[model samples]
Target chain A: MDIIEILFTASFWAAAIRIATPLILATMGELICERAGVLNLGIEGIMVVGAFAGWMAVYSGTGLWAGVAVAFIVGMAFGLLHSTLTVPFGLSQHVVGLGVTLLATSATYYAYRLALPEVTSPPKIAAFQPYEIPILSDIPFIGEALFSQTPFTYFAFLLVLAVAVVLYRTPLGLAVRAVGENPSAVAAQGLSVTAIRMGAVIVGSGFMAMGGAFLTMSAFDSFFFEMVNGRGWICIALVVFGSWRPGKALLGAILFAAFDALQIRVQQTEIGAEIPYQIFLMMPYILSILALVVMSRRAEVPAALMVPFNKGER
Target chain B: MNLRKNKRVTMRLEPIENPTMLRRLGLPAAVLAATFLVASLLAMIAGANPFSVFGLIIKGAFGSKFAVLETLNRATPLIFTGLAVAVAFRAKFWNIGAEAQLYAGALVTVVLGTGLLPWPAFAILPALFVCAILAGAIVLLVPALLKTRFGVDEVVTTLLFNFIFLLFISMLLEGPLKDPMGMGWPKSARLIPEARLPRIVDGLRLHWGFALALISAGLVWIIQTRSTLGYEMRAVGLNKEAAAFAGIPVNRVLVKTALLSGGLAALAGFSEVAGLKGSLTLDLSPGFGYTGIIVAMLALLNPLGVVVAALFVAGIFVGADSMSRAADVPTYLADIMLASALLMMVLAIMLTRFRVVRG
Candidate 1:
């Protein structure tokens, strides 16, 4: 195949879409949690936990959807754990979050080892099947490649829209946002501030878990130790870059994902050889830093973020 | 009859809710302790004695003269990274880029080690040290710029840089710095003999780097306790607005401390390459930056306490490796131990800072 031909292959874009899936969903998950005033630093660890939980359920014959379900359950459990420490325990928010990340990293990595100590080959499940959009698949140079993506990719797109709605149009969404901005005011208005934040983390983390589950069953088809990597942290930056809006965060994810997709595409073209692969790998990180620094002056973070609310003082 | 009796159940209640600090940690501490107990129990289930397994890890880390020295050797970088974290944490700055800064420092040392610049023995050593410090400072600039200029959260910026530096180092090793001696191994050329850190023992790998680590700790302590910059940084950490109103040059102080923190961390990275490996490799940090976070907390952000915390944590990590090899145990046991210790430290440290009320 010529360079163009090879670049246009269905599998290549599938891989690109695959790479974008976890980041897109996880970032959206963070977008919700942060907008509600809880910086769940455990997103990486939570993603890993979801990966392992999803894998375990599927590996035991529950099928792929069950794997995704378990991931959500796992996410909710962690959300509860983190909320208890920061919200009620009134511990240092950042430290607690960082601690959660470390704990999650070691727990999941070690657990995977013990559960599969004797297996030489990594466990696998039937990977997600690609579903091509009927008419869109016919577009030249883009359709078959972009439209024929795994079902999870499409789900990620829809969830972005869903989150945008829940965050703006609904009463529960307004309350969540209110709690993040000023919990004292929310509490005074007869809302359970902790409950709103907790609910957001629990629900948001469920999406993040699906991001992890998608990795095992849809994206890559197996669990690796620390599978989520640092995409969770990247999402934190994206939420800021997007100004804490769901629709905006998705755009940021795609933009970064586009940079990621472009890097992989350009690498295959021998033209990218002049610049080392490290530069390409570092592109996402570099972009994140640049985007945050360049556009952050007017950035709006949740006013009550990282602050503990005292029920009595309010 | 049974329903009627259940409706009259006794309502006895205990007056004390959380009798001890440990009780408050009942959930996590229990989860953590039970997890280890079960992990150790798994060792027993794996046909190894749990007690012996634990004993072997302790022995492997400190049983022999070489083992103890090696543990100290491994921990040298952690002291600096831990301080890097502590300084930032104290100043309320989240500089997770210590890992990247570590690589930046190592990269500079590699350039110097491979004769990228020419100077006398006396001049080359000092110049390389300064270069390593500067390399670290440059990498930290991204986060500082984002935080100060754009109001971007430094946590994410610094974190993203960690991966960037790692990838940058990988590219260098695979391209400009590839070893040409034998095979396709990805490491830079070995350092010149003169530039190598002097070893302390005849047979052991322990070197003057350990002393350098001690001196670094002392310098950090003096600055934090004695100097005005340290006072300003600490003040900013407590409350940025208040410090700024008091006429503390907040931005300048933050930038300077960030550079110092990065530079210090870079020294640790440089030492590891120069003193231990004599070259650069991809596995430069096995999460020293992450571990430094735990060290900072364990030390309560006290610079002097950082040394003790570093050694203790290093002992656990190395001990785990040793225990794993000798007892046929998984090295992950050590991670479990460290996690438990961190949880313990968090609970203990928080007690001194704030009071947990029943209301």
Candidate 2:
């Protein structure tokens, strides 16, 4: 099929939305963390732990929602460890974040081996199936593309809106934003900057794990190694692309997913047949670098991002 | 007057003007004990006796002459990558793309060593080494330039480059670099015997790469302690604004640091292929670049310490692999131990300069 013909198909849009589901969730998660002034480089490994935890829970006969909860809680446990070191000890965020990633990933792998020692291939669980909304499903083109998705996709979209509201409309959001921009100002206001930053990291990390859980529970049926495959890092770039805004970050996720879907389809076409498939696989990372270069020039980074705040220190 | 006031005691970290020798030594010992405790807990969860597991690991690492040599072989690449990370981190450049640079070096090695060079072994070997360094240097230069000119964050860009470079290498392996006579495998053609690194001793599996690594570590130590560029890098890392004020070209120093770091990491790939593997494959590195961060951190970013650190890290992996076969626990326990060690070491380093005081 030609490029234009592919773009017109509802399947393409449906695939793009499906692809964007995890990115949307994870980007929102990262946006929250960055907005709160902590760069969670642990996103990648936390996502791995999430994928394994959620899938393992479901595989063990827990309900789907319970699996998600399991993933979120486990992710939060790691986040607590992360925040404890970064916030209270005021360790180098870069080193501590990477250490957390290493810890989470290795711990997950060890757990997976202990849980399923005999199986060569990962066993599949009955994952979340697509749910068609009553009226929205009947719309001509848009309905099939957006409404007819797994409950996970719907939750991801709703999260963007909810995050946007909380970030701009609520007092808690203001405090969170204040902590990232000017922690001393927030501290002067009799608010605890440490509490806000730690809380933001913990909650934000839960969302990131849910994004990972979406892959095994919604996108695919089984947990596997390297399945998250740099999506977490892409979400980091998306936060930059969105300038740490929820709505814009959601859009960035979808746009990136669309390109991803397009590349997968393009590989099957005649023009794609002549090029090495690895070239097609490389588009997402290359595009992320381009996007980072384009947006970083004007991106308004959090003023206190990566800067540890020691209260009462001159 | 304050004595009559309510004295609320709360713990807070206070800067220490000078740490006593015992405090410096005790903190690190405590950190090691903490890491060991965590590892023991993990072993218990895996249904293995923690003491036996620890015993197996130590025996497996240093039991036989063969085991010691195996660790030295594994440590060769780590030493290079660890030095690479230590140097860049010392400059505060955050060069996390050492994995990609290592592959870049290997790619160059295969391209030139696979009958592409018709000269004598002496000329061809040096040429291949120089080209590998150049390739790795160029790969990292892109991100460094982006950071310097476009105000981009090197962390994300460098991380992204790892994925991109891997795909690029995959393309080459499947297309042009594909071994023609070998069975279907995504690997490059083997290097000529002339291009290979000589074994350190006859009948010994160890190669000259280990010697090169030791020499490299000594050279790096000298550079870090005795060179002007090393002084500039330390100044930049300590305080960028102050370094710039002191007439150091901060951006230029960062770019130069990237080249040196990338080149050092590339040597790992070169050594792996030239000294042992002789052919390039996708799994040439099992996350050596990422593991280098652990090594660098554990060493406190000290150049000579990186050598000792790399050896220690390699022993764990070599030991863990064997221990897994003899025990019920998974081999990834090594990774968990090292990661915890990294975190604990960083915290301990901080405690050496700052004391938590109750007020």
Quick one: best lDDT, which candidate? 2
Best by TM-score: 2
For model 2, residues B1-359, the per-residue Cα lDDT tens digits are 11111343434678998899988899888988998899899999999999999999888888899999999999999999999999999998998899999999999999999889879878988888899888889999999999999999999999999999999998988888999865889999999998899999999999998999899889988988999999999999999999999999999999999999999999999999999999999999999999999989888898888999999999999999999999999999999999999989989999999887764
Q: A129, model 2: CA deviation in Å?
A: 0.5
After TM-score superposition, the amount by which residue A257's alpha carbon in candidate 1 deviates from its true location, in angstroms, is 1.9
lDDT of 2 at A255: 92
Least well predicted 10-residue stretch by lDDT in candidate 2 chain A: A187-196
Best by DockQ: 2
TM-score of chain B of 2: 0.96
User: Counting only residues 3 or more apart in sequence or on different chains, how many pairs clash (N, Cα, C under 3 Å) in candidate 1?
Assistant: 0
How well is each residue in A1-314 modelled by candidate 2, as lDDT tens digits? 88999899988999999999999988888888889899999899899999999999999989999999999999888888888888867888888888888898999999999999999999999999999999999998899999999999999999999999998999899988998999888877767777788888898899999999999999999999899989988999999999999988988888999999999999998999898999989999999999999999999999999998886385
Backbone clash pairs for candidate 2 read none
Task: Tell me the lDDT of candidate 1.
Answer: 0.78
